[model samples]
Target: MNLSPKLLEVFTTALAVPADQITADLDYQGIPEWDSMSHMILIAELESSYAITIETDDLLEMTSVTNVVDRLKKYGIEA
Candidate 1:
């Protein structure tokens, strides 16, 4: 899956996990840095990287690694 490199960096850093560990099935709860603050940072990071605003519905639905790609795709981002 070809994803945005900046998005990958944001997720990996925000989750405190290696980039390779990030995948479609990986849930946010599985990472330590996926807490409240991190979630906020992740949201901001995604916005900055994609140059697009994420909707509240998409924000609430972002539970797993795949969900990020999914939500962004809905906004016209290629997966």
Candidate 2:
């Protein structure tokens, strides 16, 4: 649970996945928990978590854990 609590909650809710399945190594593909609709849900979840917003470019670029973290940082979010 190294991720921000809000982020973690959103990931869990959007992907319908278990805590054990979540990690920095996890990506948006090759996993039953990830899909197109789930991706959109993840976007919304992330926006809500940071209490800010993301752009279409960032949203489409969110392919892995690192991407998510980096984008949050770009938004001046510490988590």
Candidate 3:
């Protein structure tokens, strides 16, 4: 699957948000749906989808959709 679509799925499913509402500018804690619980869900979904482990610091740094894409790239994922 394409990275963007997969990311949308993760965000949509984890945060229970509409796919159309997901954008690169979408940020963690920016919405009620993206609370601490949903944040971990998003992290797990991303890790499982990318088949890569993320550092704790990276997890903490994942503040936005664009940030996720950039961090995944650091792991050699073509986001």
Candidate 4:
């Protein structure tokens, strides 16, 4: 499946990157904009958008776009 539009929006907004730059290969620290602070912002945006609380373990595992999609899947959010 392709990356969800909502997921892409969250990434672009939180990381301040263009949508074209947010590929499946994108990972934490892969781009300068996706730093520590932005990660928290990403998490918050995700929580609010999906209406689910991401646990610490899941948070630690969300290192890449693919991984984030996987984590969201566990929450029943087909991202």
Candidate 5:
């Protein structure tokens, strides 16, 4: 699935990866750039970009791009 430009920017900026690499299967720690350190950055970026406070439980569920998208759904977000 293609990501919205805003969502694409979040992944790219937080992970320091190319936009093309931000696929649904992009798993946490599955890539060198998306390691533990970057995961926290990614979470912070998500919160900032969406203006939503993610819960601790939801954080563990954010294992992949698809998972992040799903998690956002809980907040009534379209990304």
Candidate 6:
């Protein structure tokens, strides 16, 4: 499971955005598509995809693609 592609897929599908538009620099709430509802959906997608539970602090810290990768790393996932 390559993390990059999986991340893109999750964000794209969850946010209803184009795959090419998602980047490491893309931040949560940085775009209209990444609203509160989409954030929860995105979290769900990520949790299901990685098969891990994210703590509240970590969930709040997941602001960008880079942040997500870093957080997942702590859970034994590498991008």
Could you give candidate 6's per-residue lDDT for residues 3-78 as a string of tens digits?
4777778878899999877877888889999899999999999899989999999999998878988998889988
How far is 32's C-alpha from truth in model 3 (Å)? 0.4
Report the poorest 10 consecutive residues by lDDT, candidate 2. Answer: 1-10
Lowest-scoring 10 consecutive residues by lDDT in candidate 4? 1-10
| Residue range 1-79, candidate 4, lDDT tens digits | 3778898899889999999998888899999998999999999999999889999999999998889998998999986
Clashing pairs in 4: none
Per-residue error for 66 in candidate 3, Å, reads: 1.1
The TM-score values for the models, in the order shown, are 0.83, 0.87, 0.88, 0.95, 0.96, 0.90
Error of 2 at 79 (Å): 2.2
lDDT (tens digit, per residue) of candidate 1 on 1-79:
4557877898877777778887778776676757878888888888887788988999999988788888888888875
The whole-model C-alpha lDDT of candidate 2 against the native structure comes to: 0.81
Off by over 4 Å in 6: 1-3
Backbone N/Cα/C clashes per model:
0, 0, 0, 0, 0, 0
Model 3 stretches astray by more than 4 angstroms: 1-3
TM-score of 4: 0.95
CA-lDDT, candidates in order: 0.80, 0.81, 0.84, 0.92, 0.92, 0.86
Using TM-score as the yardstick, the better of models 1 and 4 is 4
Residue 58 of model 2, lDDT score = 89
lDDT of candidate model 4 versus the reference: 0.92
Candidate achieving the largest lDDT: 5
Give the better candidate number (2 or 4) by lDDT: 4
- Candidate 6 displacement at residue 41 in angstroms: 0.4
| Per-residue lDDT of candidate 2, residues 1-79 (tens digit) | 3887767777889889987777887889858878889988998888886777898888888888777887888899765
Residue 7, candidate 1: how far off, in angstroms? 2.1
